[model samples]
Target: MTALPLTALPTARPDGCPFDPPRELAALRAGHPVSRMTYPDGHEGWLVTGYGPVRAVLADPRFSSRYELMHFPIPGGPEGTLPPAPVGDMTGIDAPEHTRYRRLLAGRFTARRMRLLTERVEEITAEHLEAMAHGGTETDLVTAFAQPVPALVICELLGVPFADRETFQRHVHTLMSLDVSPEDRVAAVTGMHRYMLDLVCTKRAAPTDDLLGDLTASDLTDEELAGLGGFLLGAGLDTTANMLAHGTFALLTHPEQLAALRADPDLAESAAEELMRYLSVAHTMVRVALEDVELDGRTIKAGETVTLSVEAANRDPERFADPDTLDIRRKATGQLGFGHGIHQCLGAQLARVEMCVALPALVRRFPALRLAVPAAEVPLRTGMNVYGVHRLPVALA
Candidate 1:
């Protein structure tokens, strides 16, 4: 088969449309779900935009998630590129090595275990909502509520001191940001590793009742433990925080949907799923083919990168009816928001718990919640890997 024209990824969303995937991505998926695209660095690769193909590729063992194997799909030079994930960062490692860490940690994040954290999540949500109620009539939800709720939850689960949140959060911000210098990114990563190393050592001496402490029973070394701790901390913090902030923005802007959720608190679970599907923040992921493999009739050669547009896939019309619409009542099962397959998000349930507890609690607490600024003026985190707002100023009228 002749290859599709090699074009750059269509990453630009329509002006003023925050909840939708990039317009070009949707168009591309509709026509050529798998098409050749040139990365910013000028490497030609495949872009999978369809729901089935994206999910299939994510599940396929032939596709490699190793960081060193992928080419950056987004534009920018050396600064935009990230080196391979460090030792114990499970996201970058393939099976066996990846399976080892995953096995030790997966037991800790089981549905039953996560459900056990519901009461604690409720407490955290209530505390933040209460603080917001009295702190001011108007404030940035991202800072005061969205960011901190999950931040605190992760602290409790990881046994990290909540007081030192600013230290880790700032470092995480550096690590996730596209604007920072390599030096600063390295510094943030190094700083986090050092902090986690000290904590891991402490945990080794006297285990606490937390995820890291639980892992001490495993044969992981101090360096590996430190890396995993930092990795887990960074993973837990930013993604869900953005989801809350972005989900709130999505709900408030769509009044009927917001009203549906507010009128029925029981809608929280589906509402969180709908929000995740609607705002696919961790929009794009890459997987390089390990060898020649047939996918949807096309052969993806080994070492050629395939950018999986899960954001576009989530909105695929075939899989989702009126996929662009935000309907909280819709049963959003199989949404690729947390992704699919072996490398699916480790903390997906915890994130779901955070979103389900925090987003609805936020709305219920401030029945009169609204955007303090015009929706247009609210800043978007377009530059970062995580899609969300920088500040979601809201009036708890």
Candidate 2:
């Protein structure tokens, strides 16, 4: 295959951070709404940043998510712009297949169902706070608070033995880290696959009333079950962990907002929405044009990759007035934090419930909390899948 020309694609940023593509995306939106570009992995694809185009690509079933598994059709990646092999296979399938697999687990992730886990989420958050205090007020929240909350929550939800959490959590971090090699990532994925396989078999032998057990009883093949279980484990762990860490950092840094949230616990939902908007954690949503489609006056040929900049769309000036400033009271009418259309995050309700419970509990538990390291001194995991602080060192009040 001939190398795609860089004539139209913008220059690659030095770091090539996926999480913080907001800036470069801004430039793309302003200069070329539907620009041709090469992805970090060196695959050639169309970068669609405008509000209308991004929404169109995401909502249309004509744009498939299946192409994400194979080598991306771009230039500059390890395999000359090919899509890297995925750890699991669910992310790359289409339609009724995607629909059926997603449905098998939908009942477990509903907002009402997730609500049942609130007390437990708050209990875990409080226990972590007490542990942080005993360990000394000055502690790394990422390790002490942020990471464990979601890790424990997801573990309990999946009915995975708490003893296995250390192993699973470690793999989740390595698998999601952009700095890690693709081979290491594939290893992590395989490890998780083995874990899920063992879990399913164990559940079959001694079924429990948990999500995984229910999945075992479903009319799904082992491959389908593995795809669904692997998908849930990864989806539940990485994104929520980032949210806890990033949301905490965002709140702590913005003292007024933090105070507001602390003062009124009800603000947690709105605060979470605002934080999701501001942080815009997941960098972009990948899609393949199922067929030739016209979007915002640009013709996207069938089979081309269309990368929707979710972070960019969330902050689009045309969509949100004064989008840069974070405002909790503001209504998050159409923010795609959980995405949109058929493939929107199934665990979104659970994630929000966890956040709503955890945030208020953290502040109420430690009213005098303040950062041990200065805000600027805190190292951010920049340009990655889930942007967050590496460590949130804090002294409990």
Candidate 3:
């Protein structure tokens, strides 16, 4: 077999087509499913673009998710050896440790448990929509609607005071920002850490009826509880916020599809799924090979890093027909939107509940809703870890 080309990690998306993954990734997936990759640190690695290969790598135990074991792919990202993930940051660890955290948190986020939050999510969504309408016709959906709905829901779930959301939201924005100075990032993280630590202590003294309150009963140490609180807060807030913001941008740009969704409110669930598959807010993830593993006709040697192009994998033509087009009616089951396998997103169900309620509600509330600015002019979160819109300017009818 001819050797595949060695492409650099972090390819750019096509100019003007913000919904699609980097065209280079789509091209690679069409021909070479598995190809050689050169990391920013000059370390040779592997990039998996096909849906099959990407899923296999994520599910395989031989591919370690430990932060210290993997090399950072993006330029100017953390270099050299990184510390192990703290308690509750399951994404950076594997097996028994991750299993432990998953088992403990899984019960709290099950389909049934998350379903209980559906009513509350709807209430939050309605409250935000009302607030937006009261504010005016023209508004930035990111600040007014997208950001607060999830922030408030997650806050209520974790038992954090709703009054303090602004502080945490600012910190999360800074922490997730790709262009923020290292100093700013460090300060954002530290501030959040301090806040979570204090919250954990409060829960210990007066355990309420929230997630943190319930966790206080567990045998987990204070440090672990604090770390876990921060983990949940960041995970629950940033991911869904991006989804809401970016999903709205996508719908406004695709007017035909948006009209279909508006006409049939029942399409909310599938529409959310399709948006997740299309946008793929969490665009990239990495894993390090623990040993020589044969995969898709290529050998991933021990200690080698593999970058999974989630955006590419979700859009693989082999997996979905006409993968580039945004069709809300498409039965987009099995899309790796929230990922797959053991490290799949823990809050997937809750996110679905939020989107299922929010999107349809927004469109239905304002029958004449439309974009306030040119679709191309809307700012995109190009460099952030979470792919989304910086601001979704909308004209509420």
Candidate 4:
């Protein structure tokens, strides 16, 4: 058997198709589902690109999600050994440690809770739509509609004051931005943590009707609550915001899909799912092997980092029919848009509610919505952790 060459991680999306995963990643998935990876730090690891392998790795407990354990894939990403993830950041921990935080917060985001928020999400969606309509024909949809809807929803859920939202949003943008210097990134994160810490302090003094308030009843300390609030805030804001922005961009570019979605408003739910699958905003994740694991007839030795390309997995031909094409009606079941296993997104249901309500509302409200700028001129977040458009200028006729 020919040895599969060691491939570098692909960070660039192919020109003219910003919604699609990098062509290099697609080819890698097709040729070798599990291949050798050479991290920029010169560490040898494995890259799992296929749907099956990516899902398998995510499900296996032997794979560690610790920040201090896994090798960073991107060039100039934190080099050398890193510190352990702070309390309440579930993404950086494994197993029992993760379980504690997940258990404490899971109830807050349960199906019932998310359903209760449905009315609020609808109201929020409508409010944003109304604002966009009033803003005139030519406006950046990202700011006018996409970003605010989710940001406001998350703010309400976390009990953040409406007055602090602009500052909070600014901090989030800085932290998530890829072009910012390390010092600026640190400062942004520090600012957010400080804000969250203050909020946690207030919640401790007097609990309210929000997620943070609900958690204050638990035995968790003030610091832990602050960390958890920050984690949830960042997660809830960036992922769904990008999904709304990029998904709208995808629909606008593919008029047929947008038209079908607009015509059959009942298709909103499925359309949201298809859009999630088609434009996976949270594109990649990393896990480290804690034990020797046999995968696809190859052994991934313990301590080796594995990069799961969620974008590639979602687009795997074997997983979904006509995977590359955006079909609002396609039953996009088993997609990794929210990831898999114990680490699956806790806010998945909330995100779904937001998208199902927001997208359809925008389309129905503005039947003649179209891009103000040329498709090529629409700026994309090619460098951010979440894939999305930097700004979507649209004319809501």
Candidate 5:
């Protein structure tokens, strides 16, 4: 019998190709699509790189998102099985359990609701753009604009104190960091849980008008509420924050698309979608097979993990025509940056509204905006779960 080709997961994009997924991932997608992969912990699994296989796996009920069922993909971590998904961490648990929490929250994040939130998003965008415009000709866009807009919006939506933004954001970065140790990850999550539990208690006593407050009307316990709120805030803040920052970086680098957005702010909607497809900042999605499954000509055994390179799948030439290009006009619907099926990002519409409003506003507000540092000097979040620029310094004029 022939031995299967083996490869390790590729985390870092090649130099000078920050917008691209690791070249090896693309090669695998084109050639292997689904191939044998060795996880850092020495568990051999499957790597699904092409669009077809990735979507199939994500949409399949046989693949489980349960935290305890999977192996950590990161090179170094605690050497043991994970606990079951905490009370309300929808991302780590499969439905009908995920369905209950998702059904409760999905209505609030619907298109109509998000569209209503657009007014507030516009207000926040304007505030940050104004601050950036007046603050200085040069500043880190990440600190000044990208981070705050979504952070503030999510806080307002979730009834979190904007004053506590610094606290949670710090913890979130640690959770998302691939290089962070197991002890640090636990500590950060512990801190977030403590803060969120206190916040949930406050919301329960007073019942402010926001998602958390609304959820408080349900029968969920303080611990469940805390986990859910922390989960929601991390979902709402970190991904959108980096998308804004890194999307801005992508636009600034892709001069033509940037020009298009500045010319017609209406293009922001499509541009945001295209950017999500092109950049795919939340690049990896993990699932473990609950039973033996044949996918794309490969047999994935029961209990083996299948790591999906969303970045690679999004760029699969078969699924997306000229997939590598950053074309703001492309109809980028059905892109899997938000994943597929039940576990798809619940806050996706909210993110769309934020990105549509903020990205164009930033481009138009600073017509002469350019990187304050060289392209290479701007730091990339290469080692983090979220793929983006860590610091984006820009000159606004």
Candidate 6:
């Protein structure tokens, strides 16, 4: 009922904030629906915190996801210098263009296509758990389990060389880690673009039947190719890695959930959903308004940024009863973990399938997977856009 400045919203969480972001949204739904706030880039935008309002913002045609593609208004800065465009094909395009490229991406991530990758995912999970087993008792699960498996799987899918994983992973670490400085962010983005461009050239020369090669066959120009490859690298590498790491951490800490998942492998499917809801890794969804829009009686101006707290939406009390409690058997049909609308995650199916396969396999293979150190003592990576456990020290009992 009362209007609040977005600056009045809480930002500092030294103990580490999970990606479950809608704390402000919950406050908004309870009190303030449309709140004004400054974005990380210092631009003023409206933060939509309620479920209906957020969903309307996502589905409405007046909102544009292509703010990254064009010189759009930033709230505070002098006409924002369009940061160098993302060197990959993804959320930066509008309907016809986005739809065109999405068709190409849809082919590789279909349920049928994902089924083919299942065995490989299981093998990779088993291999990582085995390697962790061989290493002396305590191993950082982020390094030992979470990071490598998805990196290997995604690399295999895109035909990126395994030897190049460390190289690309460094660029990825710099890009996703909260620790990187502003200057370092640009450098990492540029470096990642360069890595992807070189990989594209190699794929051009000796075409393999991987996702990269498939994209080259499309009508995309060289610039678009870079965008496509860069998008995949950024989206594929970190998101899956976060899911794997954070999901594992969530399960390992919840003994009853872990035991239930171990007892019935079918629980893996539901567990994956619960974990995605629990972690809500992608954090927030940013959209620019193409026209002035009225949301919950508050008008958002054209060309202004509107961020939907997908993390909060997923945990909305209206949507999920007892939203904070992780329930493996919980029906998770409408959760916004991968978002909703036409721009929903293209790789959601693959990511979910990977989790269903990877999580159960890791626990079944090790049977005694428990944290090697106290949960409180574990070091979490700070300042990251993508939330994940940095180090999950676990022992094979």
In order, candidate lDDTs are 0.88, 0.72, 0.88, 0.87, 0.89, 0.74
Off by over 4 Å in 1: 1-3, 77-82
Off by over 4 Å in 6: 13-25, 39-43, 68-84
List candidate 3 stretches off by more than 4 Å: none
Error of 1 at 222 (Å): 0.5
The digit string of per-residue lDDT tens for model 1 on 120-192 reads: 9999889888888888799999999888988899999999999999999999998888667778878998899
Query: What tens digits encode model 6's per-residue C-alpha lDDT throughout 1-397?
Result: 5557665234343443443453555777557656776654556777766767778877787888784523322232224524544645467667887888878788788989988998998888888877877887777778887878888888888887878878778887886765556688678777877777788787788788888887788777766786677677667778888788778777788889889999999998888888888677776667888888888888888877876766677777877888878888998877777877888888888888788988888888778888887777766554566777677788877
What would the TM-scores of all predictions be?
A: 0.97, 0.90, 0.97, 0.97, 0.97, 0.90
Better lDDT candidate (2, 3): 3
lDDT of 4 by residue, 1-397 (tens): 3436664688888888888898889888888888899887888898888999999988999998998997778776666545578667889998787898888888888989898999999998898888778877788988888888998999898888867878878887886766677788778777888889998998889989988898898888888888888888888888998899888989999999899988898998899899989998889999998989999878999999899999999999999988999999999989998999999999999999999999988888999989998999998887787889889999888
Model 3 residue 172 lDDT score: 82
| Decoy 4 TM-score against native | 0.97
User: Which residue pairs does candidate 4 place in steric collision?
Assistant: none
lDDT, residue 312, candidate 1: 95
* Root-mean-square deviation of candidate 6: 2.9
* Clashes within 3 Å, all models in order: 0, 18, 0, 0, 0, 10
Candidate 4 stretches with Cα past 4 Å from truth are none
Q: Write the per-residue lDDT of candidate 5 for residues 137-183, one digit (tens) a residue.
A: 89999999889999999999999999999999999999889888778
What are the per-model C-alpha RMSD values against the true structure? Answer: 1.4, 3.8, 1.3, 1.3, 1.4, 2.9
